[model samples]
Target: MIRAARILFKATLWFVVLSVLWVGLYALVPPPFTLTMAGDLFQGRSITKDWTPLADIDPDMPRAAIAGEDARFCLHHGFDWRAIAGAAARNAQGRRIRGGSTISQQTAKNAFLWQGGGYLRKALEAWFTTLIELIWGKRRIMEVYLNLAETGIGTYGVEAGSIRYFDHSAARLTPTEAGRIAAVLPLPKKRAAIDPRGFVRRHGNAIAARVGVVRRQGLDACLK
Candidate 1:
């Protein structure tokens, strides 16, 4: 028992040290590929990803994502307590499991962790979210999220999504196109960004409207 405990302690210490160094390095350099992308590749799924700088991406794309995912993104640090409380209350009432994850949390998960949900993944996500919030800030967080998020089956990033769905570069995405992409973000594997139908179409319209609202109210001022 003593030997096992000692080994566990050493492993835990090493893990913490490596995690810190990894986060620090990513704060300065863009990650080569995310864990999710790697997992997909290992599963023999084709990946279509094009790394594009935030400046090269259309301004509407980030705005639409912020509108759809976390309207209070700029106001929060790493988590949104109001959204979390609302989701928890709804879940307790037996409603569908809705996630209240902010862009920072999503970025942390996409960049560092594999895709899944559980206490362990959530805990690690929270840790990485806090680290990115402190080190990467809002702009960097949004940039990484936009670039790493899976926008469709095998499609990664706004650039690749734009090209795949609209036959255009991300920098040229129109408001409606941006909204469609953002709408599919919640369930990219099931939703279609291009030629969206039913719920996706309505959701995209809602996101587009909110994009205007965020812009007018300067809800995304932190990125600027």
Candidate 2:
């Protein structure tokens, strides 16, 4: 028992050191690829992504993301307890599942962890989220998230999504265009950003409206 415990302690120490180094390295270098992208390849889908700097992506894109995903993005550290509480309450009531993950949390998951939910994954995600919040800060987190998030069936990044859906670069996304892309973000494989119907269309419109509000209220001030 003593030997096994010692071995476990050594293994955990090595994991902690390596994970910190990994997060620190990515602060300067864009991640090469993610597990989701590799999964697409394994399933015979071609990966499409363009790594645009946060400055090149239109302000509306991040604003739309903030509005549609996390309204208190600028205020949160790495997690939003209030949103998590709300989501948990709604989930307990048997509504459609809602995630309380902030952009920081989402970035950690997209960059380091795999898709889907499990206690183990969520615990690891929390660890990575803490590492990134300490090392990457808000702007870098948003930059990484926008570049790594899946925006379509095989598409990754807002830059690629912009070109795929709008035939234009993400550098000049209109509010509506940005909102549509943001709407597709949560369920990229299932939702179409262009000519979206039903919930997606309505949600995109709402997000578009909220983009201006996000800006006026300085909700995305960290990005600026």
RMSD (CA, angstroms), candidate 1? 1.4
TM-score: which candidate is best? 2
lDDT of 2 by residue, 1-224 (tens): 99999999999999999999999999999999999998999999999999999999999999999999989988989999999999999999999988899988899999999999999999999999999999989999999999999999999999999999999999999999999999999999999898999999999999999999999999999987
* C-alpha positional error of residue 205 in candidate 2 after TM-score superposition, expressed in Å: 0.6
Model 1 / residue 186 / CA error / Å: 0.8
For candidate 1, lDDT tens digit of each residue in 84-106? 99999999999999988999999
Model 1's number of clashes is 0
Error of 2 at 139 (Å): 0.1
Off by over 4 Å in 1: 1-6
TM-score of each: 0.95, 0.99
